[model samples]
Every structure is written in C-alpha cells, then in structure tokens.
Target: MNQPITNAEKLSKLPWSIGSNALVNVFVQLTFLGSVFILFLNTLGLDKSQIGFLLSLVPYTGLIALFIAPLIARYGYKRTFVHFSVLRLLFAALLLLTPWVVSNFGAEATLLFITVVVTLFSITRSIVVTAYYPWAQEYIPKSIQGKYSATNNLFTTLAGFLAVTLAGFVLDLTTGLTGYLVLIIIGVLCGAVAVWGVTKVPGGAPVEVGRGVMASFRDTIAALGDKGLLFFLAGVGLITLATVPLTSFVPLFLQEEVGLSSGNVVLVQTGVLLGGLVSTYLWGWTSDRYGSRPIMLSGICLLALLPIFFMLMPRYSPVSLYVALGIAFLQGIADMGWVIGSTRSLFVSIVPPEKRSEYTALYFACVGVFGGTSQLLAGQVVQLSSGVSGSFYFFVVDAYTPLFLLSIIFAIASLFTLRTVRSDTQVTVEEFAGMFLRGNPLSAMTSLVGYHFAQDESRVVAMTERLGVTRSPFTVDELLEVLADPRFNVRFEAIISIARTRPDPRLTQALIDVFNGTELALSNIAAWALGRVGDQTAIEALRQGLNSKYHSIQANSARALGRLGDAKTAPLLLERLQNEPDIGLQMAYASALGNLRAKEATSPILHLLHDIQNEGARRELALALARLVGDEGHFIHLYREARADFGTATAQAVSAFKRKIEKVLNSETKVLSTLGACADNLARDQLTEGAGYLAQLIEVLPADHYDPH
Candidate 1:
C-alpha cells in the first residue's frame, strides 16, 4: 500500500517550478555560438580539407564532454555551470590566440591551431550542454517541459538572428588581422556573458550528488536500460545523419556550383537561420501545447521532402534558394521536435529520479557517438565527390541518396514508437473499493486480477476511481501485477487506474518498458499520472515529452505537471508562459498551479495574468490563487484589496465569505452595505452565485479570519 498524500508532495513540486530558468540560459548560449560559427571559421587559414577535418574533430571532443556529464550531475548543476563558463571562456580566448600561435610556430603550428580551436569549442559546447540539458529534466514539470524546451529554443533562435546579424556586421567592418582579432574578442566576451547568464539562474538540487566520476559514468550507461530510449536514439541518429550531408556542404555547394557571391552566401545562410528561428519556435510552442510524437512524425515526413526538392534545384533559379531555405526551415522544425521527443524527462519519468543524471549522460554519449560518425562519413563523401570529375551536383546528390533513404526508413520506424502506454501500474476500481470497505486489500486486488482475467478493461478504469479513496499495500501489488498482465488492454487499464489512484514506482518502470508502439492512449494517460505523481523519477520522461512531436501529449503533460506543483518546476513554467502563444494551455497551467497550491509559482502566474485578454480566466485565476494560499490573513487581504478597487466577481466572493464567518462567530452583527451590493453583482454568474449566501451572513461574524479560506 502507498502512503497517503501530504504537504511534502506539494513541496517537492515547488522545486520543478523554479529550476527551468537555467535551461533557458543554456539554450540561448547555443544559438549565440551557432550564429557566429561561420564568421569565426572564416577567420582561420585552414584549407577546405583542413576545415572539414577540423570540423569533424568537434564531435569527438564533444564525446569527451558527454563522457563527463555524470560527474556534473554528481557535483550539481551549479558546478556544471561553472565548468561550462570556464571552458567556454577558454575556447573564446583560443580563437583570438590562434593567429598568434600560428604566426609564432609557422607551418608546424597549423595542425596544433586547428586542434586547439576545435578542442576548446567542443569541450565548452558539450560540458555546458550536458549540464544544461538536464536542468529542464530536473526542474520543469513533465507536462509542459516540451513547450518550455521548444520556447527556450525559440528564444535561442531569436537570439541567433540578432547575434548573426551583429557578428556579420562586425566582421564586415574590418579586414584581415584586425577583423579576425575583433571577432575573437567578441567571441570571448559573448562566451563569458553566456556563462554569467546561466550561473545567475537558480538550479534544482542534484539528485545524484558526490558520486565518483566513474560511478557517474556507470549510471549514465545504465540509462540505456530503457528500450524506448534506445530505439528513439537509433531513429534520431539516422535523422541527424541524413541531415549532415546538407548541413555541412550546402554553403560550399552554393558558393562553388551556383557561382554565388560572398554576400549572396551570407544571404543564403541568413535565410536558413531565419527559417530555423521561425520553425523551431513554432514547432516548439506547438509541441509544448500538444505532444512530441505527432510533431516529430510531421517533421520527419517533411524532411523526406527536402532531398526531393534539393534534386530539383539544378534547373531552378534564385527562387530555388528559397526552396532550399524552406527545406532548412523544415529541418529546424524536425530538430526541435526531435529534441523534445528525446528529452531526458521521458527517461526520468520511467526510471527513478536517482538515476536521471546517469541516463542523461548516457543518452548524450549515444548522440555524440552516432552524430560524430555521421559527420565524418559526410565529410569523407563530400571530399570524395569534390575529387570526382563530372557535374558536382549529380555526384553530391548521389552521395546523399543513402542518407535520405535511411531517414525515410527510420521515420517510418519512429511511428512504431509513438504508441501511448498507461502512466502507472495499480489496481482496478472494484478491487480498490472492496479493499477499503471490507478491510481486505488483498481481496480487492484479487477482484482486479479477476477483472483483468475476464478482460473487462472499461469497468476496471471506472472502478479505479473508487479505489483512490484509500491507500492500501495489497492495492499496490495488484496494480503492479496488472501492468505486467499479458493482455494489452488489461495492462493499459491497470496503468491508467493506478495513475488516478496514486503513483507507484513499479508503474513508472513498466511505462518505460512499454513506451513504444503507435497507440497513444496509454502514453497520454501515463503522462497524466506522472504529472500527478510529482516525483523526480518522472521528470526525465516529462522533459522528453516537452519537445514531443505530438501537440496533444505535450499539452496534456504540461497541464498535468502544472497541477503537480514543485518549486523546481517554476522557472520552466515561466519560460513557457513567456514564449508560448497558446491561450488554452496558459489557462490550464494557471489552474493547475492554483490547485497544487504552487506558492512559489506566483511570479510566473502573475506575469501570465498581465497579458491575459480573457477576463473570465483572469478572474478565476485570481480566486484560485487565493484558494491556493489557503491562509486566512492572506485570503482576507486579497478580499479587501479586490473589494476596495471596484465591483467584480472576485470581490463579491471575498465579501460574502467575510460576512459568513463574522455572523457565525458573533451573536450581534452589522451588515456592510458595500459587501451586500457586491454579492448582488456576483449572483449573475452561476459560478459565483454561492457568494450571495455568504454576503447575508457578514452581519454577525467575528473579525478574525478562518485558516482554511
């Protein structure tokens, strides 16, 4: 039997609400660096071959960073942020130092310069990212983490647009050594700023603290235990690999084959960036509001179209460049979708919170391994094609054929991973009621087992609600066993029923195991259950869903987490609140937080209220916030503040409640005319009509407010 819900359940939810800010900072840094990458690369003297080789080195170096993510998890995000900033600073400094190092050492220093530059950038990028990735997983509510991740990416994309334009102008102003020096200086300054920005944001407590680096590594590797994650990585890897050919060589092809000018090349790149900026945010917002799977599938299907479009570019004009840009935009959407779908939140929800860092690090390691090989192979293909004689266009297109075909195959495979499973494993309805009423939880559990054997899934779900009134031990076992039932329907019914009743660790584990397939019913229910559970174990699973390719799953998850309530989740909620344009989701989040008594959620909640055009929702939220506080003094203060301002539904409720309390406590009471009039105004809305009754009782109540407002 599970323990009864308590104050601590609500408190744990608070942390999730607060730690999302750190992730926003990290994503912003990603955009800032990406925008300036080409400008920085141009400043180097390496030939085409050297540049390709040097670029390939980036992933290998990144692999090292991925390797150490466990250590960062052990030490805490605070230290991770420190490591990230220091490494980035070093990388930025190296960019400026590269020219001098080359000048001093001559030809002998060329390889060394490339190595140092790539090494520095790689290390900084990976370490910061490793630390940053888990921030969302650790803090943000699973329900909305997708949206938060997407919105954060959207902000980063906006930053990219601004940063690229500025970097381009800066590099354009000067020539040769002076120009390079200026770029290096700016890079250093920006890197430092990024680090500073991240450190300023508060982070969640490190779940895996003070472990040895090796132990951390072991944990990260252990994340592969989840079959869904393993397959998801494989599918995502193929997609990334498919993209490498275009992402790497598109610029060079445009410059050489199309005979375009440097300015035009910049324009093309800018166009691509703009596409990414728009698409990433758009998809992210949608993913957060909906779910990750649908969004992911949509993006993948669109990606298949890119290659076919690229093949048509041979006979096309500058308009074809637009087509290419559109394709890049679609690619950006897919990338964002992939990020959400593959979030560590998904893993965390399935696995225990104690294992989150280990899983995250392992996931990143897989990304690096697959992503690096793809880059190398892509570079080799491009290099080989460049040496071949006839029409470079056909040769390059042919080289990419395998990748495109593979992406299509994996995309189809991803559909299989889209099935939804139940949120937790628990007993059915009749069993629960029987257990509580008869004081025989085992009998109640047996009833559920009998129901499962009979395959009465619908009745099972119906009965689970009745079971929720009590928390019994045998009920937990019944629930766990139900999830392992041979029949899919039986397991699905059992999982969802448990989610509605209470969270079970076994249920969490089973969901991870069964997270594959195209049926989203189970997954959606499970997501909702995890959100309600409000434990660290479910964080990664929820985080992964934030960028879920499906809008529905993403939205439901966000809404669920908002209700779960944790301080760690506040910052992430705020990030989504700031960036997403979905009105419905915004309302759901406000309501969920209110119901969860998310005290620390005030800032973000208040911020959302400022722009809310919906009067009804705003008023409801105001009242809900008061209810959430559940403190007499605070409630009375809220009542007084609203009452003094003017006539509104909220004011009437406060006034009426005030009167009712006063009359009950004091024999002789006095009626407040303003409160009476307010109650009359409130009676028009059915939702607030109850306020009228309280208004009549205000005449005799005592002055002191009740605690359970």
Candidate 2:
C-alpha cells in the first residue's frame, strides 16, 4: 500500500538516514556493546563465563532471522525494518528495570531477566540488520555508495566517542543505580530519534517470491561454492576466532587483572573510536586506489601484532593502561580496514547484485556460528585456566596469556587464507606497504618527521618541544629534513622547532628556500625563523622578500631584517616604511629600525610616529625613538602604550621591553650619558624635564641587574 520512493527522493533523504543510523549506533555502543554494560554486569557479580555466554548469545540469536528473512521479503524491507526498529524502543525502556530486578530477585534472577531482554533486543536487531542494508541499496546509487559508507562511518565513530566519553564520566561520578538508569533513558531517547529518521526515508517495494525458505537456503549454500567467497570466508573466520577471546576478556582483564579505574578503562576503549574516526577515510582512499586485497592483508598483519602487545603488558601499572590503549587503537585501525576491504572486495564486488541478500545473510550466519562457538570455548578456556601459571620459553605465562597466544596463531593463519583471495588488482606485501607509507599523507608526514610507526602528529610535535631541552643532534637533523615536507603545517612546525636550537648554515639555507617559496603563510613563517636564526647570510634573501606582493611576506621580511641588525639596510627599511600603506607592516618597519639603531632613520621614524594611529604601531615607534635618541621618556611612553593596547599580553610584553632597555643601558652607557648632557643643554634649565627623566631612569634601573659574564 506504500507509495514507491523515486531514486531522486531516496538520494535526497540518504544523508539524514545515515546521520540517524549513527545516532542509533551511539546508543547501542553506550548501552549494549560498550564497557559500561560489562562493568555494570561485573558489579552484579556475573563472572567471565556468564558474561561470555551472554555475548555469544547475541550472534547466535541471528539464526532467528533465518526464519524472519522470508517474512521480511514477503512483507517489505522498509516496513519490516521500521516495525522492528521501533520495537527496539521498548527494550530500551525495559533495560531501566534491570537494577530493580537485581535488587528484588538476586543475581541469578537478574541474569535470567537480562538474558531474555537482550535476546529479544538482538533478534529484533538481526531482522533490522537484514532489512536495513538491502533497503539502503535500493535507495543509494552504486556510484556514491563508497562515499556514503565512509561518511556514515565517520559520523558513527564521532557519535560513539561522545557516548563513551559521557557514559564514562557519569559512571565515574555516580556509584549507584542512578547512573545506569540515566544511560537507559538516553538510549531510549536516541532510539526514538532513530525511528523518526527511518520514517523520513522512502519505502522500497516488497521483494517478489515464488520459492519457499528451503529453496532460498539452498541457493545461499550454492552461492558459497565460489572460490573467492570461500577464501574470504576462511580469512574472516580465522580473524573472528582470534578476536573472540579478546572481545570477551580484554575488558575483564583491564578492570579485574590490571585494576584500572573505570574512567581509565573507558578512556582506553575510546581510543578505538578515536582511531576509527581518523583512519576510515584513509582506508577508503587506499582501497579505491591500491585494491582491497592489499588493505585486507595489511590490516591482518597489523592485527597480528596486537596479541604481542597484550603479552608485553605489565600486570599493574600506568604504563600497562597506556599499552592497552595502544592495543585498542591499533585494533580499531585494523578492524576498519578489514571491514571496508572485505565488504567491498568479498561482498559487493564479487557477489551478483541479485543474490546479495542471500549471500550476505549466509555470510553473517557463518561468522555468527563460528564466532559464537569461539566465544563459548574461550570462556571455558578462561574459566579452566583461572589461577593457572607456567613458564613459556623465557617469559612467564598466566591464565590469560594462552588466549593471546591463540589469537596470534589464528591471526597468522588468516594471513595465509588471505593469500587465496582473488581481486581485480594485486600487489605484493612489500609493494602495498611501500605505497601506503609513500602515498598516504599522515604516513608520509610521520615517517618524514620521525620513524614513528603509529603516525601520530602530536608525538612529532612533542618531540619538537624537547629539542632545546634535550639537545639531540640526530633528532635536530631529522627535524631539519621535515622542513621540506609537502604538508605546509608540518614544514612550519619543523622550522619553529629548528629555530629554537643554535644556528646552523643548513638550517639557514632551508629557511631561505622556504622564504622564497610560493606558499605565503610558510614564507612568512620562514622569514620569522631566519630572523630567529640571526644568520647574516639570509639578509639578502629576506631583503628580496620585502618586495613580495603579499603583505605578510613583506612585514615578516622587514622584522627579520631588523633582527639581523644590519645598518646597511636602514635606508631601504626607511623608504619601505614611508611608502607602506598597511599599519601592521609599518609597525614591523619601525621595530626593525629600532633593532638596527639606524640614526639616519630618525626623521622618517618620527614623522610616521606622528601620523600612526594604531596603538601597536605607536608603541613600536616609541621604542624606535628611545633606541635612536637614548631618551628615558620614550621608554615610559612605550611601556604605557603596550599596557593599554594588549590586555593579557601587556605584562609579558612590558617585561620583555624592560629587559631590552636594561641590555641597551648596560652596553651603551657612554652614549646614554652623552644624550642626557645634550638634552640638558637643549632644555636650558627651564623645564629640566630631561635631567629629571634621566635621574628617575637611573634610580629605577637595578644596580646588579646586568650579568658581567
């Protein structure tokens, strides 16, 4: 009875649908799949086996959809999807009753209650899952599916981050039923929003059917005979086997074994969401350009390292928390790549569109059966090995250690299975890694900045901060090479870092080249670095930059020229100052004149000072006047103007100005004395203002302030 949705209308509503789906995922992660749920159950004294059994039940519940899928096709994908999705709102409300059930009926009854509620939630979710994707395929055009999926992932990750962070903070603050109840309320609200979003999406036609459910199952089984699908399934099966133990026990290990605070545990889990947020686009780009097989293999290889990191974690320390966080982040990256690559290569690219629903259903069924069995077995393994310990090779092994080792073995086997996967494009492992390191922006920048494998920019920036404090020549050399990186921000950071160290000719030339480059922002930053380097050789290049069409380049060049203190460039600086229209550039010229102490610049500087209205320029002109004539009154005027113009920056600027004044006073005492005598004669005892100002300056100047070294 529903009107058919036109393709154009479907496209129009696609973004809203994706956004709403992301909101639903946030609620799911916070309540069902998240650590908070596990922690809440742990608080109820439900041990590893019980928790694992509950988790295993989630995937196994997917079998219910085997019966429901036929009904879904007979009824309608959209109608069935909306009906069950709205029904999920009831489960959200039912979750609020858990604390009350635990209080009245004891842990055993609470567990039974939770099991029934969650099983229903999972079954409804399974039907919705079966319908949702096919419904999406009907509306989304094939060409933009990749982009749409990536955007959906981004939104989902961002939403999960918010949900986890908020839930963690709430649980940290509250110790009782109130926190869990509040989270349930939030989940219900988000569920309602998700249902509303689904209503906005147009409905698709119900699929036509002639055969029974048995024929559909036979067709799905027959489709699995494809070699590529079999190989892909083998790889996914191994990965799921490896990850089952981790998914079941890692949260338990962190909270129970490591004794990490709940807040810290949530922080570690949030790292996975953060990593996914960052890497989804990169994986998408790599899959499109290089081929999904390379990405899949690469992801598997990274995943293989996770068990090793787990093995290396200390029993109880802050360092162990960080290591676990690192493991979670790596897991996120690997999982994202694996999902995108497998979905694109194994599911979409390989299966015929007509058979997609059946094949996809069969795929989930295989994963669920194998993955659920692994979880149950892993739970038994953990239960049997409780308090068991031994020595393996040189390292001590414990009950949880075998699980990680098993994961490693399974992960390595998945790589072998992955070798059998067929794709339209192919590359060797070495070539794939090379292309990723060279072509990906973050990867290339990280390698260039330092050899950090994680490719985190903050780590590189932190290294830059330690340059002066640590004084490592090797590190400085590596940072210098970063100056030529294609990313402008990285190059700018490198320049700033290098400027903090002692000057070198290599660094000077690098700054010179950047100053001459076409990027105006970098050019301006390079000018500042050259000035900080105090390299006289760069003066000519900086002088040329003064003629640049960009005002920032000219202003920065003039400031750098002043920092070099070359008196020979005074006339040119003076000429630029008179002709310059921009008030900020004029301030740079005046400050430069002060740095150079060019007596010949006095007339033009004084003329411009009278006409300048900008407070910053007026302050700079006062400093220039004091530097030119050695007048104490000019210093006082400069301090007052600086204090008035810059509110919070005023104190620091004034202190720096005072230091500059002291330096000049100590170095040029004879010149200052001569100027004071000349000022006395010019005033001729009428005002005696010059003598009074000189006396006040001498009184205020600290006698021991100058270091004699």
Candidate 3:
C-alpha cells in the first residue's frame, strides 16, 4: 500500500493497505509461522529439524506459482490474489481442528494432516504472494516504494507485537491443545479481516501477459543468464542464505545457551519488533530518496556482527537477558533494512517497468529457493554441531555456534557479491556507514523522518536551513527533495545549503539540472553550487550555461567553470571577454581566464587593460593578466593598493609582471625567457598556495561593476 504524500488517491487508500498488512501480520505472528506456532509444535514432541522443515516449507512451496503465473497473470493478479487469499484463510481455519485430528488419528496421522493442511495453504499463499508483487508494483507509485514498504511494515510489526503478546499470555494461562486452538481461532479471525482489507484497494486487473507458459520459463531462463541481473540475484541469494538462519534459530539459541526462561525470551524477542518499528520509516525514506544497495549492504554488515555478539554473550545470567534483547533489536533493524532494501531494489534497480511481472517472478523465486535451502542447511548445521561444545579465548561454542559461524561467513560473502552488483548509486557502503559514524545519527534520522512535516514555506525553509547547518551526507536526501519544492525561496535556499555537503553524483546532477533551468535566480545559484561542489561532470553543463541570456547566469557560469578548472574552456573565456561589452561580464570572463592560467590570455588581457575606462574594471583586467602569467600575490597587493597609492612595492610587482607580458607580445627573442619566467612564477602556485585568495576575488565579483547599492 503506497501512501505517497502528494498522490491524493493513493493517500486515501493508504489505511486499507496498512490495515490489511496489519491484519495479515496478526494472523501470521500468532498461529502458523509465529513463535507460538513453533512452541506449540515443540511441545507436541516434534524435534528442531522437523520444525525447521515445516517452517522452511512455506517459502519453498512458493515454487508452485512459477508454473501457474501465466494463468494468474491472465486472470488478473488482484482477482486471483483475493480469491486465493480467501481460500488460504479457510485453510488456516482448519488448523483449529488439529487437536481433534491428534486425538482421533494418533501422532503419526496428526503430522500427516498438519503437513497436508500447511502444504495446501502454502501453495495458495504462494500464489497470492507471487501475484501480489506485480499487483503491488502496479498499485504503489514508484517514487514511494520504500516509504510504502516501510510504512506497511510499521503497522504490520505493531499488530504482530500485539498478536504475539496475546499468544504469549494465552499459552501461559492455558496449556496444551486448548491454547493452540484459541490462538488458531484468533489467527483465523485476523485472516478474515486481512482478506476484507485487500478488497478495498484498486488495481489488480489481469495484464496482457505472454501467451504461453513457455514465455515465463523463457524469461526465467534469460534472467538466470543475464550477467547483471544474475549477479544481483546472487547477492540477494547469499544474503538470504546468510540471514534466514538467524530468524529460524536465534530464539532457540537464546533459550538453550543464554539461560533465559521461555517467558523472558518472548519479552527479549520483543526487541526485534521494537527495532523494526523504530527503523521502518527511516530506512524506507532513505532508500526512496537515496538507493537501496547501501541499505542492503548496511544490513549485511549489521547481521555480520551478530554472530560474534552471540558467541561472546554471557550465559545464564540477568545480564544475558538484556544482552540477548540488545542483539535481537539490532537484528530487527537488520531485518527491516534487509527486506526493504532487497525487495525495493528489485523494482527500482533490477527490474524494468514493462517487465515487472516477468522479473518479480524471478526475484521472488530466487529468494524462495535460497531461503528454503538456507533453512535446511542451517538445520543440518545445528544438528551436526550438537556436540560442538568448547571454549576459545573467551568465546563459547555450542550446537548453535555453527549456525552463527555459517551466518557470519555467508554475510561476508554476500558483501563481495554486493560489490559486483551494478547500481546507479555512487556511494559505497563504507560512505553510508561513515555518514552515521561521523555525523549525529539521531539528528540525521529525526530530520529525515520529519522532512515531510514541512507543509508551508516557513517550515520548509527551517528544515532546509537545518540540513545545511548539519552538513551531513545523510541530509542529502532531504536537500534533494527541498531542491524541487515549488516555493522559489525554498528552492533558492536548498541550492545554497547543498553547496555545504561533500560532492555527490545525485547532488551534482540535481545542481546541473537546475543550472540548465530557465529560472533566473535558481539557474544562477545552481551555477554557484556546482562550482562549490566542483564535480567535473558539471563542466559541460556549465560550458552550456555560459551561453545563457542573463548576464548573472553567464558571469556565474564563467566563474564556476574557472572554479571547476575546465581549462579546455579558457580560450572560449578569452574570446567571450574580448567581444564582451558588459563590464561585469568582462571581469568574470577575465577571472576565469586568469584562474585557468591561459598564457595566451595574458597578452590579450594586457592589451585590453589600458582601454578599460572604469578604474575597477581596468584593475580587474590587470589582475587577470597577472594570474594568466603566473603572478598572483603581487597583482593582488597591487590591485588593492592602486586605489590608495600606485607607486611602491605594489607598483614594482605590477611592473615586473607586466614585463613578462611585454615579452609575450613584443619580444620574440625573449619569448622563451619570459615563458620560463611565467613557468617559474606559476611553479610556486602549483600546489595552489595563493589559490584561496584568487577564489575569494572571483566569488565576490567586482562589486562596483554589478551592485548599485
């Protein structure tokens, strides 16, 4: 369910989607896949491996949708989803009869009944899930996919929290089959509500899908072979392989190794839900504005740490409970980041819009396959490592230790695959982590979440100013959003604030796009922002900007190109300055030429210096000549002193610089000697010792030339 702030229609339906998600999670978190389900099964004399098989079977059974997708696509994903969701709900209700089946049929027969019931339910649910993605993809607007996912997660996680808490209380009060039966009834009721909510949202009509089943198969084949898509899937698969085990076994590890009571373990597990609730919006917002790859990488990194933490966690103590809760909270954050990033990245980064159905099928199937295999693999490890008790340098090892070790290894491998997966984002995982590490993490999260609260111009300006003041890379998303605000003053301030952060491709491109805009003020400031960012990618755009009709735009573009040091445009600057009639614009072009150290520009600037009537403009041309010939300090001193007293050390420095220009024009025999002199003069500035002063002069503009006040 997408709740795009600007889309009124989508906003109106947001509650239905969120409510539906909450209901579904309530059902899920109580009966079938929830902790209550596992505990109930365990009390029935089922072993861990058998429990893992049942849990793993849910995702594994999703493979049935692969062959039936064309039918689902032809019949309409929404209609099929709603129809099957109802059927699945009915099947979920049958679990209420499990106690009777056990009493009548004996233990062997009971497992068969449960298995058959769950298998059928899983098949129908798989169809609903597989069809749901393309439908959801069509239903949700692309811009808010991350927000939509995160927001839905928030509601669903909250509902799950209540459902799990209820189940915990019910089981505590009523033991054996009666407690599970009550839980199943509640789950069934929640499922009914979930099914009702799904009908409220629009768009799930049948698409004009491929004609044959072979079409989906062909697409799947192509997806598996395509290097880029395949590599991304590989990354996703490795990550899935790494993380599925943690959710499956970590609770068991806490109970067995950490010496937490079953009741305390449930409370400890609430931390995961809390963590997810806290981070849901922030991760979604970040992914939507930024990209999902970094979030995914960050999730992997966080998951990679848990194994070590688990190993070092003190056992059988009050502190162990808190420690386990802290680790579970981190796991919750990792879970949100992983799911939101991986799933959203599928649509935005991996899949083509037209091929959403085709790609979504492959994406889910990849996760399903890896997810199923990971469960079985993790179960085998846990079983095999049952005798793995030992101690190594303060770290405790147990049957659960191998699962943690495997998780760590798989997480590390997933990172390498992440690096290979091509993404449009230029930011590395390290940079994204560093943003939080270096800046105020709490401030960054609060500002990002509150970004949309700025409804009026005043609030918008205040938020934009905060972003600029914080100067964190984490604030770049808000800055990008603000840069597009309809309010002129808001956009203006955003550009200025963007100048304060490190140069980013997204920010650089936004500035370049604004630079090419028709708005006079915005385009001018955009030019200045690009110069401040100093990204070479904007050089061509700035060069195009030099042709703008507004004098301010032209001057700012010329100066920006100089700041960017696009030396290729120095000759162009010289030509524009030579033909320019505007005094201020001439000064700007001269400044650019000077900054570029255009040796040929030295002679032309010297020739134009005497003809310039305004004393300020004349001195500007002389300064340009000084820079072009590699004399910065002297010209700066002379340019300032000439207003008070022209004949002194300042005069001598100006004269010496002028003598080099004289050789370039009139003395052919001394041209090489003067060239040597210019080279020698420029050498001192090779590391740009006086470059700051030069920049100071260019940025200020000739106040006498432009500002009447």
Best by TM-score: 3
Candidate 2 — what's its lDDT?
A: 0.73
Please give the RMSD of candidate 2 to the true structure: 15.2
Question: Which whole-number lDDT from 0 to 100 does residue 382 have in model 3?
Answer: 86
Kindly list the per-residue Cα lDDT of model 3 for residues 256-317, writing each as its tens digit: 77887555666665778888889898889778766888888888888899889889999988
Q: Show model 2 residue runs off by greater than 4 Å.
A: 1-10, 390-396, 437-709
Ranked by TM-score, top first: 3, 2, 1
Name the regions of candidate 3 deviating beyond 4 angstroms. Answer: 1-14, 207-219, 353-358, 422-424, 449-451, 480-709
TM-score list, all predictions: 0.51, 0.61, 0.71
Give the top-scoring candidate (lDDT).
3
Question: Candidate 3 at 191: error in angstroms?
Answer: 0.6
The per-residue C-alpha lDDT of model 2 at residue 434 equals: 60
- Write down the lDDT of every candidate, Cα atoms only: 0.56, 0.73, 0.78
Model 3 lDDT, residue 174, Cα: 78
